[model samples]
Target: MNKPCFLLLCLVANGLFPVYAITPGQTEKENPMTINMSINQQTYEISLSDTAAAKAFVEQLPLTLNMEELNGNEKFADLAHSLPTRQSRPGALHAGDLMLYGHQTLVLFYETFQTSYSYTPIGKVIAPEGLKKAVGDKNIAVHFYRD
Candidate 1:
Protein backbone atom coordinates (compact mmCIF):
# COMPACT_ATOMS: atom_id res chain seq x y z
CA MET A 1 0.00 0.00 0.00
CA ASN A 2 2.85 2.38 0.89
CA LYS A 3 4.63 1.65 -2.42
CA PRO A 4 1.40 2.24 -4.41
CA CYS A 5 0.67 5.51 -2.62
CA PHE A 6 4.21 6.75 -3.18
CA LEU A 7 4.01 5.98 -6.87
CA LEU A 8 0.71 7.86 -7.15
CA LEU A 9 2.19 10.91 -5.44
CA CYS A 10 5.21 10.90 -7.71
CA LEU A 11 3.00 10.67 -10.82
CA VAL A 12 0.85 13.55 -9.66
CA ALA A 13 3.81 15.74 -8.79
CA ASN A 14 5.36 15.17 -12.22
CA GLY A 15 2.04 15.89 -13.95
CA LEU A 16 2.09 12.34 -15.32
CA PHE A 17 -1.23 11.52 -13.64
CA PRO A 18 -4.40 13.38 -12.68
CA VAL A 19 -5.69 13.42 -9.15
CA TYR A 20 -9.20 14.15 -10.41
CA ALA A 21 -10.85 15.77 -13.42
CA ILE A 22 -12.03 19.35 -12.99
CA THR A 23 -15.78 19.56 -12.77
CA PRO A 24 -17.51 22.18 -14.95
CA GLY A 25 -18.88 24.22 -12.03
CA GLN A 26 -15.47 24.41 -10.37
CA THR A 27 -13.91 26.62 -13.09
CA GLU A 28 -14.68 30.13 -14.24
CA LYS A 29 -15.93 30.35 -17.81
CA GLU A 30 -14.96 33.00 -20.36
CA ASN A 31 -17.49 35.66 -21.27
CA PRO A 32 -18.29 35.39 -24.97
CA MET A 33 -19.38 39.02 -25.52
CA THR A 34 -16.35 40.83 -24.16
CA ILE A 35 -14.50 43.13 -26.62
CA ASN A 36 -10.87 43.95 -25.99
CA MET A 37 -8.94 46.47 -28.06
CA SER A 38 -5.38 47.64 -27.69
CA ILE A 39 -4.82 51.13 -28.99
CA ASN A 40 -1.41 52.84 -28.78
CA GLN A 41 -0.20 50.19 -26.30
CA GLN A 42 -3.21 50.80 -24.04
CA THR A 43 -5.88 48.14 -23.64
CA TYR A 44 -9.59 48.60 -23.29
CA GLU A 45 -12.08 45.90 -22.45
CA ILE A 46 -15.78 46.37 -23.11
CA SER A 47 -18.21 43.84 -21.68
CA LEU A 48 -21.74 43.51 -23.03
CA SER A 49 -24.75 41.61 -21.87
CA ASP A 50 -24.64 39.07 -24.71
CA THR A 51 -22.94 38.09 -27.95
CA ALA A 52 -25.69 39.58 -30.08
CA ALA A 53 -25.02 43.06 -28.75
CA ALA A 54 -21.32 42.63 -29.40
CA LYS A 55 -22.00 41.41 -32.95
CA ALA A 56 -24.28 44.35 -33.65
CA PHE A 57 -21.59 46.75 -32.48
CA VAL A 58 -18.95 45.13 -34.67
CA GLU A 59 -21.20 45.06 -37.71
CA GLN A 60 -21.66 48.81 -37.53
CA LEU A 61 -17.93 49.44 -37.75
CA PRO A 62 -16.07 50.10 -40.98
CA LEU A 63 -14.73 47.18 -43.01
CA THR A 64 -11.27 47.64 -41.52
CA LEU A 65 -11.15 47.90 -37.74
CA ASN A 66 -7.60 47.29 -36.62
CA MET A 67 -7.26 47.80 -32.87
CA GLU A 68 -3.48 47.57 -32.63
CA GLU A 69 -2.62 50.39 -35.05
CA LEU A 70 -5.44 52.54 -33.71
CA ASN A 71 -3.87 52.39 -30.24
CA GLY A 72 -0.54 53.64 -31.49
CA ASN A 73 -1.59 56.34 -33.89
CA GLU A 74 -1.80 59.95 -32.70
CA LYS A 75 -4.02 61.48 -35.35
CA PHE A 76 -7.13 59.55 -36.44
CA ALA A 77 -7.54 61.30 -39.78
CA ASP A 78 -6.74 58.05 -41.52
CA LEU A 79 -9.17 56.11 -39.39
CA ALA A 80 -11.86 58.74 -39.82
CA HIS A 81 -11.26 58.73 -43.54
CA SER A 82 -12.05 55.04 -43.42
CA LEU A 83 -15.39 55.45 -41.65
CA PRO A 84 -18.42 54.15 -43.50
CA THR A 85 -21.42 56.36 -44.19
CA ARG A 86 -23.68 56.68 -41.17
CA GLN A 87 -27.14 55.09 -41.17
CA SER A 88 -30.03 56.90 -39.55
CA ARG A 89 -32.93 55.37 -37.64
CA PRO A 90 -35.68 56.93 -35.54
CA GLY A 91 -34.50 57.04 -31.94
CA ALA A 92 -32.88 59.22 -29.34
CA LEU A 93 -29.10 59.52 -29.49
CA HIS A 94 -26.95 59.32 -26.40
CA ALA A 95 -23.20 59.70 -26.23
CA GLY A 96 -21.42 57.72 -23.56
CA ASP A 97 -18.02 58.24 -22.06
CA LEU A 98 -15.23 59.25 -24.39
CA MET A 99 -12.09 57.30 -23.60
CA LEU A 100 -8.59 58.17 -24.73
CA TYR A 101 -6.01 55.41 -24.77
CA GLY A 102 -2.72 56.88 -25.84
CA HIS A 103 -3.50 58.54 -29.16
CA GLN A 104 -6.57 56.37 -29.85
CA THR A 105 -10.05 57.37 -28.76
CA LEU A 106 -13.31 55.51 -28.15
CA VAL A 107 -16.74 57.05 -28.68
CA LEU A 108 -19.75 55.11 -27.51
CA PHE A 109 -23.24 55.68 -28.87
CA TYR A 110 -26.46 54.48 -27.31
CA GLU A 111 -29.91 54.57 -28.83
CA THR A 112 -33.11 55.39 -26.96
CA PHE A 113 -34.14 51.88 -26.05
CA GLN A 114 -30.76 51.11 -24.51
CA THR A 115 -31.02 47.58 -25.90
CA SER A 116 -28.27 48.31 -28.39
CA TYR A 117 -25.06 50.36 -28.40
CA SER A 118 -22.03 50.84 -30.63
CA TYR A 119 -18.48 52.19 -30.33
CA THR A 120 -16.06 53.72 -32.79
CA PRO A 121 -12.38 54.59 -32.53
CA ILE A 122 -11.09 58.02 -33.46
CA GLY A 123 -7.76 59.78 -33.39
CA LYS A 124 -7.52 62.93 -31.29
CA VAL A 125 -7.83 65.54 -34.05
CA ILE A 126 -10.55 63.72 -35.97
CA ALA A 127 -12.69 62.53 -33.06
CA PRO A 128 -15.05 65.50 -32.77
CA GLU A 129 -15.41 65.91 -36.51
CA GLY A 130 -16.06 62.24 -37.02
CA LEU A 131 -18.75 62.20 -34.33
CA LYS A 132 -20.52 65.26 -35.68
CA LYS A 133 -20.46 63.84 -39.17
CA ALA A 134 -21.77 60.52 -37.91
CA VAL A 135 -24.59 61.99 -35.85
CA GLY A 136 -25.63 64.56 -38.44
CA ASP A 137 -28.07 67.47 -37.79
CA LYS A 138 -31.07 65.38 -36.81
CA ASN A 139 -32.79 66.27 -33.56
CA ILE A 140 -33.70 63.27 -31.45
CA ALA A 141 -34.53 63.24 -27.76
CA VAL A 142 -32.05 61.14 -25.78
CA HIS A 143 -30.66 60.58 -22.32
CA PHE A 144 -26.89 61.02 -22.16
CA TYR A 145 -24.01 60.06 -19.89
CA ARG A 146 -20.24 60.35 -19.88
CA ASP A 147 -17.25 59.48 -17.67
Candidate 2:
Protein backbone atom coordinates (compact mmCIF):
# COMPACT_ATOMS: atom_id res chain seq x y z
CA MET A 1 0.00 0.00 0.00
CA ASN A 2 1.06 3.61 -0.40
CA LYS A 3 2.74 5.15 2.63
CA PRO A 4 -0.10 7.42 3.77
CA CYS A 5 -2.72 4.70 3.39
CA PHE A 6 -0.50 2.20 5.18
CA LEU A 7 -0.01 4.64 8.00
CA LEU A 8 -3.76 5.12 8.22
CA LEU A 9 -4.26 1.35 8.37
CA CYS A 10 -1.75 1.06 11.17
CA LEU A 11 -3.46 3.80 13.12
CA VAL A 12 -6.82 2.10 12.69
CA ALA A 13 -5.43 -1.25 13.71
CA ASN A 14 -3.97 0.28 16.87
CA GLY A 15 -7.33 1.91 17.74
CA LEU A 16 -5.83 5.34 17.43
CA PHE A 17 -7.95 6.55 14.49
CA PRO A 18 -11.44 6.12 13.17
CA VAL A 19 -12.04 5.09 9.58
CA TYR A 20 -14.60 6.62 7.28
CA ALA A 21 -15.60 4.89 4.09
CA ILE A 22 -16.03 7.35 1.29
CA THR A 23 -18.32 6.31 -1.49
CA PRO A 24 -17.69 6.87 -5.17
CA GLY A 25 -18.04 10.55 -6.12
CA GLN A 26 -17.72 11.49 -2.46
CA THR A 27 -14.94 13.20 -0.57
CA GLU A 28 -13.66 12.70 2.99
CA LYS A 29 -15.28 15.95 4.08
CA GLU A 30 -18.39 15.66 6.24
CA ASN A 31 -20.39 17.78 3.82
CA PRO A 32 -20.21 18.40 0.13
CA MET A 33 -20.50 21.98 -0.99
CA THR A 34 -23.87 22.95 -2.41
CA ILE A 35 -24.84 26.14 -4.14
CA ASN A 36 -27.85 27.72 -5.78
CA MET A 37 -28.22 28.73 -9.40
CA SER A 38 -30.96 31.21 -10.02
CA ILE A 39 -32.16 32.03 -13.51
CA ASN A 40 -35.25 33.95 -14.49
CA GLN A 41 -36.66 33.66 -10.97
CA GLN A 42 -36.32 29.87 -10.99
CA THR A 43 -33.82 28.30 -8.64
CA TYR A 44 -31.88 25.09 -8.96
CA GLU A 45 -29.69 23.44 -6.37
CA ILE A 46 -26.16 22.61 -7.48
CA SER A 47 -24.08 19.81 -5.96
CA LEU A 48 -20.50 20.87 -6.61
CA SER A 49 -17.96 18.37 -7.84
CA ASP A 50 -15.11 17.60 -5.48
CA THR A 51 -12.31 19.42 -7.31
CA ALA A 52 -9.92 22.24 -6.64
CA ALA A 53 -11.52 24.22 -9.48
CA ALA A 54 -14.94 23.80 -7.92
CA LYS A 55 -13.70 25.08 -4.60
CA ALA A 56 -12.07 28.04 -6.28
CA PHE A 57 -15.31 28.76 -8.12
CA VAL A 58 -17.15 28.76 -4.80
CA GLU A 59 -14.68 31.19 -3.33
CA GLN A 60 -15.84 33.75 -5.94
CA LEU A 61 -19.50 33.01 -5.51
CA PRO A 62 -22.52 35.13 -4.74
CA LEU A 63 -21.88 36.37 -8.27
CA THR A 64 -24.18 37.70 -10.94
CA LEU A 65 -23.12 37.06 -14.47
CA ASN A 66 -24.54 38.04 -17.82
CA MET A 67 -23.92 34.80 -19.58
CA GLU A 68 -23.86 34.91 -23.34
CA GLU A 69 -25.62 32.27 -25.40
CA LEU A 70 -23.76 29.92 -27.64
CA ASN A 71 -24.84 27.33 -30.24
CA GLY A 72 -28.38 27.20 -28.79
CA ASN A 73 -27.15 24.75 -26.18
CA GLU A 74 -25.11 26.61 -23.60
CA LYS A 75 -24.42 29.83 -21.77
CA PHE A 76 -20.98 31.06 -20.84
CA ALA A 77 -19.37 33.89 -18.94
CA ASP A 78 -15.77 34.87 -18.43
CA LEU A 79 -14.73 35.04 -14.80
CA ALA A 80 -12.73 37.89 -13.35
CA HIS A 81 -10.12 35.36 -12.23
CA SER A 82 -8.91 31.95 -13.30
CA LEU A 83 -9.33 28.66 -11.45
CA PRO A 84 -7.10 25.61 -11.42
CA THR A 85 -8.07 23.09 -14.08
CA ARG A 86 -7.94 19.37 -14.74
CA GLN A 87 -9.48 19.41 -18.16
CA SER A 88 -11.04 16.34 -19.77
CA ARG A 89 -13.26 15.57 -22.67
CA PRO A 90 -16.57 14.34 -21.25
CA GLY A 91 -17.62 13.45 -24.85
CA ALA A 92 -21.29 13.98 -24.16
CA LEU A 93 -22.57 16.95 -22.25
CA HIS A 94 -25.76 16.89 -20.23
CA ALA A 95 -28.15 19.64 -19.33
CA GLY A 96 -27.14 21.44 -16.12
CA ASP A 97 -23.55 20.32 -16.44
CA LEU A 98 -21.45 23.17 -15.10
CA MET A 99 -17.88 23.36 -16.33
CA LEU A 100 -14.92 25.65 -16.70
CA TYR A 101 -13.32 26.24 -20.05
CA GLY A 102 -9.64 27.19 -20.24
CA HIS A 103 -9.54 28.08 -16.53
CA GLN A 104 -11.35 31.37 -16.98
CA THR A 105 -14.65 30.69 -18.69
CA LEU A 106 -17.68 29.34 -16.84
CA VAL A 107 -20.07 27.28 -18.92
CA LEU A 108 -23.53 25.88 -18.20
CA PHE A 109 -25.03 23.47 -20.64
CA TYR A 110 -28.80 23.44 -21.10
CA GLU A 111 -29.04 20.71 -23.69
CA THR A 112 -27.61 17.25 -24.03
CA PHE A 113 -25.08 17.07 -26.85
CA GLN A 114 -21.81 15.58 -27.98
CA THR A 115 -18.67 17.67 -27.95
CA SER A 116 -14.99 17.52 -28.77
CA TYR A 117 -13.96 20.24 -26.35
CA SER A 118 -12.37 19.72 -22.96
CA TYR A 119 -13.48 21.33 -19.72
CA THR A 120 -12.96 21.19 -15.98
CA PRO A 121 -16.00 19.96 -14.07
CA ILE A 122 -17.59 22.32 -11.60
CA GLY A 123 -20.98 21.04 -10.44
CA LYS A 124 -24.35 19.82 -11.65
CA VAL A 125 -27.78 21.25 -11.13
CA ILE A 126 -30.15 18.91 -9.34
CA ALA A 127 -33.46 18.16 -11.09
CA PRO A 128 -32.75 20.09 -14.26
CA GLU A 129 -36.05 19.29 -15.97
CA GLY A 130 -37.02 22.87 -16.75
CA LEU A 131 -33.49 24.14 -17.22
CA LYS A 132 -33.66 24.54 -20.98
CA LYS A 133 -36.78 26.66 -20.83
CA ALA A 134 -35.39 28.74 -17.99
CA VAL A 135 -32.26 29.62 -19.92
CA GLY A 136 -34.12 30.66 -23.08
CA ASP A 137 -32.62 31.74 -26.44
CA LYS A 138 -30.43 34.72 -25.69
CA ASN A 139 -28.04 36.09 -23.14
CA ILE A 140 -29.19 35.65 -19.54
CA ALA A 141 -28.49 36.83 -16.06
CA VAL A 142 -27.55 33.98 -13.73
CA HIS A 143 -26.99 34.38 -10.04
CA PHE A 144 -24.98 31.89 -8.06
CA TYR A 145 -24.68 31.82 -4.28
CA ARG A 146 -24.29 29.58 -1.26
CA ASP A 147 -27.02 29.17 1.37
User: Number of the top candidate by lDDT?
Assistant: 2
lDDT digits (tens) for residues 16-119 of candidate 2: 65667778555534566799999999999998988899999999989999999999999999999999999999999999999999989999999999999999
RMSD of candidates 1 onward, in order: 13.9, 7.2
Q: Assess each prediction's global lDDT (C-alpha) against the native.
A: 0.33, 0.94
Q: Model 2: which residue pairs collide?
A: none
What lDDT does model 2 reach? 0.94
What is candidate 1's lDDT per residue for 39-93, written digit by digit as tens?
Answer: 3333334443232323444444432332222221111222332233222232333
Give, for candidate 2, the lowest lDDT window spanning 10 residues. Answer: 24-33
Cα error, residue 74 of model 1, in Å, equals: 15
TM-score of each: 0.23, 0.82
Clashes of 2: 0
Which ten-residue region of model 1 has the weakest summed lDDT? 68-77
For model 2, state the Cα shift of residue 13 in Å. Answer: 8.0
* Candidate 1 residue runs with Cα over 4 Å from true position: 1-32, 51-53, 59-106, 109-147
